[model samples]
Target chain A: MASVTFDHVVKRYTSDLTVVKDFNVEVADKEFMVLVGPSGCGKSTALRMLAGLESISEGQIRIGDRVINNIAAKDRDIAMVFQSYALYPHMSVYDNMAFPLQMQHMKKAEIDKRVKSASSSLGLGNFLDRKPRALSGGQRQRVALGRAIVRNPQVFLLDEPLSNLDAKLRAQTRIELQKLHRDLGTTFIYVTHDQVEAMTMGDRIAIMNAGILQQVGTPGDIYDHPANIFVAGFVGTPTMNFVAATVQDGVATASGFHVKLPKALPAAKGILGFRPEAVTDRIPDPDSAMEMKVDVVERLGSDQFLYGKVGGDSVTARVDPRIKVEPGDSIKLGLDTRTLHFFDSETELALL
Target chain B: MSVVSPATKPGSPATKPVNLERRSLLSAIRPSRAILNIVLVVSAVFWLVPTIGLAIISLRPESLFQQSGWWTALTAPSQLTLSNYQTLFAQGLVARGVLDSLITSLEITVPATLLVTIISSLTAYSLVFGRWPGRSVVFLVIVGLLVVPIQVALIPVVQEYRVFGDLSGFNPFGTIPGVVIFHVAFGLPFGIFLMYNFYSGIPKEMLEAGRIDGAGEWQLFRRVALPLGLPAAASLMIFQFIWVWNDLLVALIFLGNNKHATLTIFLFEQTRTLAANYWIISTGAMISIFIPLIVFFSFQRYFVRGVLAGAVK
Candidate 1:
């Protein structure tokens, strides 16, 4: 029942310096919500506001139904896992996890039991007596998680918890985090700059740009239908390609290709958007096809990518790894009409 | 959190090989290493020669100290006796004997050291982590106090103590507590300066994490800042203890009218005797030197470098 809500939140340092501007999001109970953006986009600041570590300048943030702006951070009943893992370097693993419970004035026997169960759940049972300096980075991160979950708080906030891990461990921990969210059934608000973590782990992600949320949707929703050029470019690997195009009557024209419009647009000049996977080697329609002067061919075992210029614009086309291709070679690529997106060049908003 | 970084973990097997290679590289420069060790050993022996000479003189009879160098007692071991120590303690350990002065010195030094260490740590905790306005200015003022010499404040503080006695029943003049107050007052500026710098190096995330973990300001200081500031505090404790312990001016002026003397004053008095009691002076000097040595040795463990290395990424 601990649904979190941010109502018209604004964090301003000065008159001209606003880090988070009129931000809003409602995280349903037992849902995993990720607030993701680029560096300095105020994602971490937003999370810190929820954790009561930072003060809100203009609006109210509520856990369940209670406003937490005036509450002290310790009484907020929300646990935060810091990016640095911020484990007490002097305390043992068991003690580090038990510190929050002890702060509540819980009895010693209850503290021991909760600490023991939390340690084993985090696979830190045997390492209870060891100090944080003795553990590896991965072990310390789990200990940080162990410390967070021992409180059984109503909401959990994580600020780039996996950013410090290497790529391999990051992927492994991402899966485990989703599982933990399910088992705990607490509202989780995670902030990160990595799109992959947001895309894979978030039940729904809120994307922000320049302190403004661009869109809020499920991963498949945002991937299949982006609201603006920023969302279209921020998500997905290799990024979605945006090509300039001119729409007249019922036909859309680019530098070296044209496509028959399925729906009419109000603007004359617009940008054409498609993913690398949408550029196929097999031609489905001739009007949307163009010859690409191949500049670099990268074979990634599972898939091959062709980087080249289509007429005057550079383009990346995903092709079969088995098909032979080389730099300086010209290949004809067809843009799939069904997945094509059109945007008003001036507004940068998706039109079709 | 990958298994990739084990360089800092002491017990990690992967780090062992790296340490081994480092050790072998050191052994490769054995010739130069041996030269450095030899130089250090030679300098150490030269440094201890005077103390060794004093210890021998303290054990020798009064007649022998006047006739020859203290080294001569080493050749005639029979001349080395405990009679000088016996005479120095004739008044007994509790009175004006050497032990009594040593006890008085401890009474003055221990409180001064502990108070500075504690108050400086608390002051530093606030200076570094507190959001109060003008904190930097306050810190600068304290650090600026470090430049003021103790001599300037000696006469003024004595007057302040006399006035305080006039207003209140308890006069700090000529008492051990008075000396302790002076030492603590002067010691705080440097103590806070050191502790403030060390506490600043601790990441703010550590304290914020503590706050989210339901800890108050005091808990954060007790659990986080205090432990991390141990090296600075240890060094401060040593400096303050040694400075106050060896001080003759403050004890001389403050302990006036009081028959009790600190070890420094007592040792000074030995040199002023009609014949200059060299045996008592040498013996008392050796005794004075031992306590600071023990204090320094006990604090050696807290001087662990890179204590903050593994605490964060």
Candidate 2:
């Protein structure tokens, strides 16, 4: 197992079309570093460049102590599981897993031992003789994983490997992948557009937007303190609500409410950000609470969500499922002031 | 109809009994299906008539073949014998020519088909997956070559062969290898065109997966792209095999009617000089048809519908 480092990496397709700019990350040994972003955000491009599948336009990537920019993909000694579980359809599962070993010209007995152990670990022991077409989607995904695991390379790269599975399978595979990572203790560079996967899986998540690195932190760190407005909005479910507000003296004012800041800020205009959970149905202090005119209520059995308007701006709130609420009902909700965030309107960078 | 109509409604107590009776009635006399089957059989028989006629003519005695049409022997079954086949085989020189022609055809067709399939597959793999510069331009040139007629290149290629002989001390003008080379040249454009389109359909992720699995370029082509391209390769072999096998023009021009004549050239020579050598012509045609028929039928299984199913989600 080895740590991976991308130092000042840039992926410029053409003079005017640079996709990833000055990408830099230092993944520690045995770290599960996830690169997450929306489509066209160049997260996958960064992973591809590190994989050596794509040529880096500038800078250097090193695995352990070896610089890899001039190396071929096969020579890089990294295995990648594609978003498409690209199992060799003509070969049986055994051969699929044994392919890398065969390429290494390893002894036959050792290859068999590795393939058998990997297949069994993947719960694919019975499927060793079956072709890829005979396996289900989840099984095919496991075979892809098995193929990588058999190689036992210094690092494992997975590009949205669980995206092809059904929802239930995706959930199950996500946990299994985490367990596999723990078992292997290999440095893994995983890329995905799904924030939930990032939050649940990564030892550290690096969020990117428009080819620029937004933030790199532990999931809890990122969730509690996103560096910019984009990370704040993109990292959360139901997303963080951003309300345009103006600060005067120590008070911040918006359309339907005003709150006193803990400390005074020089910025006259800023955006207030808060998670849905921070807006609760019970108001701890009526004076600080704002009235939300509920437009739609979704009861998800365990947790209910209220989508509504607060002073002509849309807001979503996570509320108690037992509480009886309906659309067009006006309700009072409290903001957890300590959990609230503020970003400058001009820079969109976090102010607190 | 009346009974079935009442059962069409939901929760009707009469549904099951009427459904079973209607199904049995429909099965007993399905007129539309019957008409479709009859039409299919008629078309199949219409396709087979010429082949069956050739078979019968090949079986008829040479005297009877000249005296009457094959239909006459079909009615009088006793007159239809294997005598024509026997006579053609019994003539020592004719037998030698047939044997030599068969060998020559095999020598030309097998290499040509194998070379075209292998070269086209490799070229298509590179075109689709290789990261080299000018790949698109090279592919476009190959596709452009598809439109240049083989007839146009015939004279120029023969002159070029003579020039090559002058420079290299080896002329390809009237040899088996000469015919094989010509066939491979003319066959490659379409072969690459077909295989390139097919290879393009294979998910790019598949090749990427191979690369990450530590496969080099040659390994990727051999282990991933080639296996996935089997259906296209199989069909290409069948096409190139039949085209070179039955080619009279290329063989006649490049491999002149000396000793190294292909089956088609030999058959053509029989009909060209001895116009009345119907027995030899019919028998030789059947022999030539026999090889390609075996080839097509043997490799027909590779024309499988979903070879790439479940390759990717």
Candidate 3:
């Protein structure tokens, strides 16, 4: 296992078409660093550059003090599990897992041993003789994983590998992957657009948008203090609600609500950001609460969400599932002022 | 254990109600299905008539073959014998001609088909995966060559062969290699076209997976691309094999009536004689047809669909 570092990496296709710009991240040894973003955000491109599958237009990538920008993909000593699962269609599961070992010219017995052990670890012992088409999506994914694991590479690169599986399988595989990382103790660079996967899996998540790296932090750090408006909105379920407001005399005021800031600040226009969970159905204080005209209510059994208009801005609040609520119902919801965030309207950077 | 009625068995209750509906549906479609089968069988038999006639004529005595239609020998089974085959295979120039023609055809078709399949597959692999400049232009040129008639190239190629013979001591004209080269040249454009299209359908991720698995370009081609392109390769082999095997024009022009004559050239020679040797012609044609039929059936299994089913999600 080795640390991976991308220093000032830039992927420029043309003068007008730069996909990944100045990407810099240091994934520590045995660290699970996830690169998460929306599609076309160049998250996959950054991973591909590190995998040596794509050329870096500028800068350097080093794996354990060895620069790999000039190396061929085969010589990179890294394995990638593609989003497509990319198992050889004509080969059986045993052969698929043994392929990398075979390419290394390893002994037959050793290859067989490694394949058997990896397959067992993946719960694919019974499927070693089956073709990929014969296996379910989840099984194929495991086979892809098994193929990577048998290589015993310094790092494992997974490009949205769980995106192809169904919801239940994805959830199960997510936990299994985390376990796999723990067992292998290898550095992993995982790329995905799913924030939940990043939040649940990553030791540190690097969020990107429009060829720019927005923020890099642990899930808790990012959730509690987003570096920018994009990271705030992109990393949460139902997303964080942003209301355009003006800060005047240390109090931020919107159309129909006002909240006192923690400290006095220069008066300026800004956006108030708050997670749905930070908005409560119970009012702690009447002065800190706002009336929300509920437009839609989603009851997810354990937790209910109210999607409605609060202070002339569309907002979502996590509420008690037992509370009876319907569309068009008006309710006073309190804002957890301590957890609220403010972003400069002009720069979209966090103001607090 | 208590005795259980059939109706109480698992799936029996649900299946019983659908049985009547399915039976009525089957009855409604049965007549058309029968008609379709009959029509298919009839068409198949119709296609086999000429081959059957050739078989009967080749089996009948040469004298009887000249005296009666092949159908007459079919009615008078006693007259039908393997004497014509025996006479054709007798120790003489006739037997030598047949044997030599078979050898020459094999020498030409085998190499032509093998070379075309191998070269086309490699070229298609490069066209699909290679990152060099002008690759598409090269592919476009090959596809453009597909439209250039082989007849148009015959004279120029023959001249070029003569010039090559003049430059070197060895002349390809009137040799099996000459005809083989000609066939491979003309066969490649279509072969490459077919294989390229097929290889393009294979997801790029499969090759990338191979690359990250520590496979070089050659290993990628040999281990991954080649296996996935079996269907197209099989088809190209069949086409090139049949085309080169049945070729009389190139063989006649390049090989002439020398010792390296192919079966088609031999057959054409027989037809050109004033007497028109019907028995040899019929028997030789059957021999020619037999080889390709064997080839087609032998490689037919590779024409399977979904060979790449498990390669990608």
Candidate 4:
């Protein structure tokens, strides 16, 4: 078992540009750690640095007790599933899976046993003799996974491993990956830009933005309590609604709606943040009901989303699908004040 | 091998979309295509007639070879005999010397082809994947070297070989090794150019994947880069082999009057003699043609693409 530590890791390309700025994260042993962010956000760079495919410009990264800064990629005792899969074309599926084991100078019987077991586990037993070119995309991806798992390395680094898969396969693989983490009991450092993968797969998610670590917390912690405006806006679908508001005496008021805050932070002007699901059709708190000028209404069987204007700020509300609402309707929706997050307008940091 | 089903198939293209390609062979032969086929066949026949004539002449007796055209033997089959070849065999110096030249040609060509191929592939691999500084600059320098013709390097290289011999006491002149060295040197830049361009198209991720699999740099080259580079390397080998096999200038300038006279020099010597030995020239020409033909045919099967089709998304 190995836990990876990145101490003040900085990836600077030049004097003027730095990709990962003083990043620090300690993944516990056997923990499923995900680095999630937008494109060009240096999440992949951080993972690459950990995988020894990239060099750390400053500071150090340690796996278990060893500082792996100078270690060659082959000696890092780690396996990675790339976005492109990168299967060896000349090798058969069986050979591809056994390549690393053979590279270790393993005995033929041991190599065969591991390769057969890994390929069978990956459901690639039937296609073991086929070259990579003859297989489908999903099959080739499984061969890549089979190759990585066959070695049973100390750590697994998956860089958007499911990105090349279709949507249905990605969802299926996400569950299998979590199960894999459980079975292997190895530290998994997964990097992806897809928030749903982060939320559904990672045991602990480290959200990064613009080369800086934004927040490190469990899915529930990140979902319920975002660290700042960026995390709030990035983590959820239909996005969180942000309203420029004035906070005074524990009361936050926007253009048309006003809500009472639980506790007041030391800020006069702040941004009010709330997820789409927080606004409901049922009026739980009639006192906090606000008027919404609905511009578009979407019914998705399970939920209904209303995209509209609550005064000058546009907001989206997820309500009971049974509730009938349409465009150009002026509706009264209840905002759960308990779920509200107040961010300091100047700093964009969450206040409550 | 193709999706074009026979007309008898249940799911033939006739059921839908009016496919023209699946029509009967007779109908498929359009006027334009027929004309194209005829033109191609005629051109091919025209191109091969000289080699056919040489083969016939090589089989004929010297008396028949001098008296009649080679085409006359096509109708008079009895006139063709192996006596000329027998006479060639009987003449020990001429026949043994020709065979020796053939052996010498192989020695020069094989090593030149092999050395150029291996060194060029290694150099190209370094230029493409080695993380050192000035890689593109180095590649550009090699590309610049490609424009330099062997004619320009002939005198300087000969002088350099002398200097090398004077310093080392193993002067390259009067030996086939000297000719091989020249061919390998001139073949390298083009060989590297072809290989570098080819290796550039391979996905860099495959090599990175190799590294992650605990493969050392040499293993990555041997296992990944080398296998994927076969087609380019094969063609480079064939080109180098044929070019060296047919070369006269470098052999004459470097390996002059040596025991290992190459086939090209042997043919040149045939013409230099006062009698102008047509028999040796034609017979030797046939041997020279056959060597490259066999080489080309043997290597052509490896020029396959799509080996990397599913290696990545």
Candidate 5:
């Protein structure tokens, strides 16, 4: 297994149309790096370029110490599992797994041994003799993974591999994939559009938006510290709440509420950011709290979410499940002071 | 098993005669199927009437031709004789001409079918998978050639073949190879067009997966693209085979030499004689029909749609 590196990579279809711009990342040996973004964010294009499935329009991608810009995909020593499983439908599971090794002219006994071990590891022992058409969706996905594992490539690239599975199966396979990476200890470059998959699966997550890299950090780092307003709004579930506010001399004030900034303001006016769970339902008091008229209450068994308006700004607050409230009810919610973020009005960079 | 009486069970909450009545109602559609079967059988018989008459005419003695229509002989089973077969065999009609035509037809059909299947698949693979400059334009050109008549190319092709023969010392015209070559060329445009359109529908991810599996272009075509393309290939083969098999003009013009006549030419020869040998022509026709039927039935399984069924979730 080898580390992969992309140096100032750029993909432009024409003069005006660029899909990946000045992208750079170094995936250390055995590191599971995930590229996450919304649709048309060029994550798949970046992965494809590394796989040699796409041509590099400007920069170089290196595996180990050698540049692979001109290399053929078959010579790149990387295996990709597709969102659509892309299994060979006519071949049995055993043949599908053995195909890459067989193409390399590996010995029959060795191909058989590797295929059997990979299938058994994936819990597909009983399905080796069946054609892909005979398998279910989850089983087909496992076969796709087994095919990749049997090759024992230098890097494993997965392009939204678990997106086809149902919610429960995706969760199960997510853990299984993490365990597989641990077992193999190979460099993995995974591309996905689901932020949760990226957050849960990667050692480091690279978030991209509109052909630009927004932030690159650990899951917790990205969660706790986003670099900009987009990363703040995009990274969290129920998304971070953004309020139009004015900051003056380390104190930030908004409509019907006020909070002290952790540091001096970089701008007199900007947006304030906080997570839903960072706010709590409370009784209105003179010293603290933002008064909101609750428009809807969503009780998700273990937690409750209040969707409402704080003055003119729409906001969502995560409160205790036991605290019952109704629509059209005016309530006071207190924000956690330690978790607040301030951004410049023009630049939108995190100021606090 | 419960031992309750029917009267007591009737008014019970669990008891309902509705399900049993509905079961009977569901089964009531069997008569419609039977009626449909009868109609199918009648239609099949209607279609087979001419073929049955041909078989009857082929079996009747030559002396009975002027006496009445061959259908009259069908009423008298004893009137049917194997004299047509014996006479045809005695004259070397079955022995030499039939053998020659069989070889010629096979010589034309096998190569044409194989060439069309192989060449079309490769073309389809490129049109669908290969990212090159002007791929769509190339595909449109191939599709456009499908509309050109084979008759339009016959004279020019023969002239070109003569020049090639003069330079290479191998005369393609008036030979079995000439007929096969002509058929292969004319069959290719349609073959490539049909297969290309079908191959375009195969998901691109499958090819990408094959590449990531360390398969080179040749290996990918053989193991992934070709097998997935079997249905279209089989269809192209069937089309090319039947067309070359039924062709009379190309074979007659390109294979006019005495040694290279195909079944169509042989059948034509029978009609051109002073006394047309309907018996020999009909027998030859039946023999020629046998191969295509065998080919069609043998490859019928490949034509099943959804061979790529579970390739994707």
Candidate 6:
């Protein structure tokens, strides 16, 4: 019923190298929090530490009211689903799902009831008697989820659980997982490298990089108001475009164009950031926006993306699919001044 | 395991006569197949000659064994009799020796095999999964013990066992437990080395997943590690079982004419006299071969090539 608090948790292997550095976040009760990052960002390490699989090197990790830094994993009242599913190969689906409960010495009837209910929830009711080897990848994943769900743990720690599933299944499971989270209303902390999963599933997403917490916010907040250049680049699909710019007064100037900046901005010189959608193709006057040399045009049904260069810096624009322009074409692109972000050139922190 | 074969449809081109091109290709390999089969059958018979000879000698009369080769029974079929077996039973010395030896061998082999499997699995589990200091050194030392010949340790072990026996007022030398203890100690190093390699091949995430799923150290070992380790444990069981079963030197040295005689000791006693009892020896040898084959086949199913398949993907 209580939240998880990670207070300046530092996982340092040596004095110089730290895999996780001062990671601090308080996951709310019954909230689905996702720690999203690229590979080697220590997201898995953070989750493992919380799960008591890895020891926290420094600082305290408290679940509910007790500090569990020294507690054994089994006593931590948490369950996990793994990327590889990690199903007990020798056990049948029912036995695999019931193992933790059976370890707790629950009555056989109760375990069977729980296993049956959990399996039915995951749509694996018909395959209870089958071994993990006889199941498909998606089925195995559901079994793993069912195993964790049967525990009815205080916290559900998932380390890229849906990563091994195919795209369609991953998407379907993403929705079902969100629904399962709502149904159980238990604290779920999911870790994944996929931003789409984090964006779709997390109540609040924490973006991490190189062992440091970059930003923690709602998906929209992170996408709209990224705390740094890393979060900005990491959170988006096509990635936010960053051009070398010089901040004169409050306006950020890039290439040969002068773009208006949002009022009350942090005064910084260097990189200017804007999403692909922030730059428009149609504008009355050309000098008001950036001018680009069109390079490659990618046309989808609903959207067309233009990959091009403004001066020497490469920029991408998401335009209407009807706009037809081949490579090596010069085009006038207008900047959405309201959404422009200026970042410090040296530290890459957000200026606006 | 069922393999798919081509199906011939009525209206398809497959209904036509076989093409000469494919027919010749198929037939040329056929003559070689007959020759290969003949060679295989001949070689099988050639290799089995000694076992067949032993069987015949065990069933022939003692005078016949002394008078002619075992192949003589094939030419003079009527000369075959069960007199050797009757004589073996009537004397009762070989029977008691064989039974004693079997009990002794089983006493040594079962525990030795079991101890090696349990100890190796525990050691391998810790070496692969546990976070401790100098595990690699410990593992390396265990593997290093593999090269140390059992003969090198026999004198010292005997001396130590003698000292231990004196302290406890119960001697271990020329005892069944001593023989079993010696075999277990010597068999452990290779067993641990083998199981360690195997356990290391399992993905670390599975164990981590187990830990997060609320499985403690013992529970993780019992539930996750041990079940997954069956293939390794089975092979190790077979290896240790056969090794201890076939062992004569360690038993001969440590168990020295003890009342609890192993099969090897029983076999050795037949050759002890000036006139070796070939009839008893052959019968006893065949009986000794019987148990190992059974043990091998029992564990043969676990020798599956890919137990780890379909586990991850």
TM-score of chain A of each: 0.98, 0.98, 0.98, 0.98, 0.97, 0.97
- Give stretches of model 5 more than 4 Å off: A282-286, B1-43, B81-83, B89-96, B274-276
Model 6 has an lDDT value of 0.86
Angstrom error at residue A212, model 2: 0.8
Superposition error at A264 for model 4 (Å): 2.0
Interface RMSD of 4: 0.7
Where model 1 places Cα greater than 4 Å from the true spot, the runs are B1-28, B93-95
Locate the minimum summed-lDDT window of 10 residues in model 6 chain B.
B1-10
Model 1 over residues A1-352: C-alpha lDDT tens digits?
3999999999998999999999999999989999999999989999999998888999999999999889999999989898999888878898889999988999999999989998898899999999889998899999999999999999999999998999899999999899999989899999999999999999999999898888999999999889989999999988998889999887788886788777877648889888999897978888788899999998899999999999888788998899899899999988787877888888898898
Evaluate all candidate structures by whole-model CA lDDT and list the values in order.
Answer: 0.90, 0.89, 0.90, 0.89, 0.86, 0.86
Candidate 5 CAPRI classification by DockQ: medium
Model 6 clash pairs?
B101-B261, B101-B262, B101-B263
- Residue B286, candidate 2: Cα error in Å is 0.9
Question: What's the candidate order when arranged by decreasing TM-score?
Answer: 3, 2, 1, 4, 5, 6
lDDT of 3 by residue, A194-220 (tens): 999999999999999999999999999
DockQ of each: 0.60, 0.78, 0.74, 0.75, 0.73, 0.60
At residue A323, give the lDDT of candidate 4.
76
- What would the DockQ be for model 1? 0.60
Ten contiguous residues minimizing lDDT sum, candidate 4 chain A: A258-267
Poorly placed runs, candidate 4 (over 4 Å): B1-32, B89-96, B274-276
Pairs with steric clashes in candidate 3 = none
- B-chain TM-score for every candidate: 0.86, 0.87, 0.88, 0.88, 0.83, 0.82
Query: Which candidate model has the greater DockQ, 1 or 4?
Result: 4
- Cα lDDT of model 4 by residue, B1-313, tens digit: 1344446567655665355454544465666687899999999999999989999888776667667899998999898777766665565555337777788889899999999999999999999988899999999998899889989988888788889999999888767788888888889999999999999989988999898899988999999999999999999989998999999988888877676688898889889878847877788888899999999999998899787788998
- Residues A1-352, candidate 5: write the lDDT tens digits: 9999889999989999999999989999999999999999999999999988889999889999989999888898899898898898889999989988988899999999999999999999999999999998999999999999998989999999999899999999999999999999999999999999999999999999988888999999999999999888888889999999988777788876888776776548889999998778753344558888999999999989999998888989998899879999998888888788877768888877
For lDDT, candidate 4 versus 5, the one ahead is 4
What is candidate 3's local distance difference test score?
Answer: 0.90
